[model samples]
Target chain A: DVKVTQSSRYLVKRTGEKVFLECVQDMDHENMFWYRQDPGLGLRLIYFSYDVKMKEKGDIPEGYSVSREKKERFSLILESASTNQTSMYLCASSLIGGDAYEQYFGPGTRLTVT
Target chain B: TQLLEQSPQFLSIQEGENLTVYCNSSSVFSSLQWYRQEPGEGPVLLVTVVTGGEVKKLKRLTFQFGDARKDSSLHITAAQPGDTGLYLCAGGVLMNYGGSQGNLIFGKGTKLSVKP
Candidate 1:
């Protein structure tokens, strides 16, 4: 069974504080993604990493950064968490190639920056 | 920006009811995928349609890709409470994936509720 685990399911952070959301995949997939889901905006991609130390900015990567030091681990970092940054964060992983590759996601972390 | 739009943002119905959700886009896609997400969880891939005018079935759920490759629909024969979830449609473009998962544009998603 494929499993993606996030560091926290719920988190509260003070404004201007640094926050880190960790995601680990047991499948060792080559591609990992970070996304923030909002009420009406759907899922906006933050950042994605295809391999160790290689990353790409997604549609909404402005306030977030990502690190992938290992194939199974991808981390999302918020340098200065603000009230507007509070949202549900999702992490996903997928195989690199082949036909229609699908992403497998973790349970998600609901962060509230106050 | 390739925008995929879904209609009827929210739907509530009783069990055994039939419903259809539509996903439309102006940009042609190499493939389209449907996913179902439960609360507090990430979306899970339900199906992917590659060929235009193709129809695929998974039990009571039916997925169709339009001939123009710019639209898709999901139909439920008999929606059960277990089928209640947020349905998301994503359009993908074929490219060199390399370390990247293929680029996919996602719709806002349709939230469905089935009550017993």
Candidate 2:
């Protein structure tokens, strides 16, 4: 079965601290995405990478950044953790072709900033 | 900007009840997809409808795409407690942003609870 694993199920960070969340997919898909899920706003994309060392900002990429050093791993970084940034972070991967929109997602990391 | 609007943000029903969730948009999409996310888990793809006026069925669930390709709906028959989850509808659009080929516009999602 295809599997996407995240580095942490839950995390707590202090305000102004730098935080990192990791995601790894066994499918070796070419597309990776980072999103933050909030109660009323839904899942807002933070950043995405189509290939190694390639990254693109999404609609809500202000407080977040992403890195794809290898094909299997995608990392999400919080430059300065704030209380408003507390949310469930999701990572997803998909193929590179026409059906690349079909994504497989990881369990998600719930981060709390204080 | 493309936006998908989902109706009935929250639904609670008893086991064996029937329900329908609607997703509507003003912008046309190349495809529409349905996903179910259980608590603490990421969304899982349930179905994808590419053709206009297409209807697909999986077990007790049925998904339909509008003839205009701008809306979609998901219906469940005899829903069980296991069916409780957050249902999200996403529309696919071709994108050339930063060389990214495709992107998805997601609705806010409908949270469903089935009481057993």
Candidate 3:
């Protein structure tokens, strides 16, 4: 079985604070993604990394950044946390290039910005 | 944006009942995937349909892809309480734009509740 793990299951931050969400996958998949799930909005991609040091912006990338310094870890950073950024964040991993067409997700991290 | 629309946002049914969920899109896709997500957990891949007009079944669950590759459906026979969860449909085209090939664009999802 594939295991995707997130650093924090729950987090609370004050406005204008910096937030970091970490993810690690044991499957060594080359593709990793960060998404935010909201009611009525579904899962919207924030950023994705295909390889170490290579990143791509998804549909929603504002006020967020990503880091993929290693093959197994991907991190999502919130530059200035705000109430609008509070939501359930998910991390996923798949085989290189995503040709496999399926993503294995981690237990989400519910971030609250106050 | 490749949009996937799922209908019947919520469904409540009794055990032994049959139900079907539909996912629609205006654009063609190389494939579509169905996932079931439980509370506090990530979505799990249930099935993937690639060929247009194809039907695949796993145990009591049946999945069908539209002939145009623009839609798909999931049908469960004799639904069980254990099948309760949020069902999401993701559709996307295959491209080589920096590892995004075959990435899934998702639907809002359907919350299904099966009571025994």
Model 1 DockQ reads 0.64
Q: After aligning candidate 1 to the native by TM-score, how far in Å is the CA of B115 from where it should be?
A: 1.9
Tens-place lDDT digits, model 2, residues B1-116: 88999999999999999999999999999889999999999999999899999999999999999999999999999999999999999998887755547778899999999999
DockQ of 3: 0.68
Structural similarity to truth (TM-score) of each candidate: 0.95, 0.97, 0.96
Query: What would the per-residue lDDT of candidate 2 be over residues A69-89, giving only the tens digit for each residue?
Result: 999999999999999999999
Which regions of candidate 3 are displaced past 4 Å? Answer: B98-100
- Which residue pairs clash in candidate 1? none
TM-score of chain A of 1: 0.98
Query: How much is B48 displaced in model 2, in angstroms?
Result: 0.9
Higher-lDDT candidate of 2 and 3: 2
State the weakest 10-residue window (summed lDDT) of model 2 chain B.
B94-103
What is candidate 3's lDDT per residue for A42-69, written digit by digit as tens?
Answer: 9999998878998999899999999999
Candidate 1 residue-wise lDDT, B1-116, digit = tens: 78999988999999999999999999998889999999988899899998999999999999999999999999998899999999999988654654435867789999999999
lDDT of 1 by residue, A9-106 (tens): 99999999999999999997888889999999999889988789999998988888889998999999999999999999999888876456677889
Better TM-score candidate (1, 3)? 3
Best by DockQ: 3
Query: A57, model 3: CA deviation in Å?
Result: 0.9
**Per-prediction backbone clash count:** 0, 0, 0
Candidate 2: deviation at residue A71, Å? 1.1
Candidate 3 TM-score on chain B: 0.94
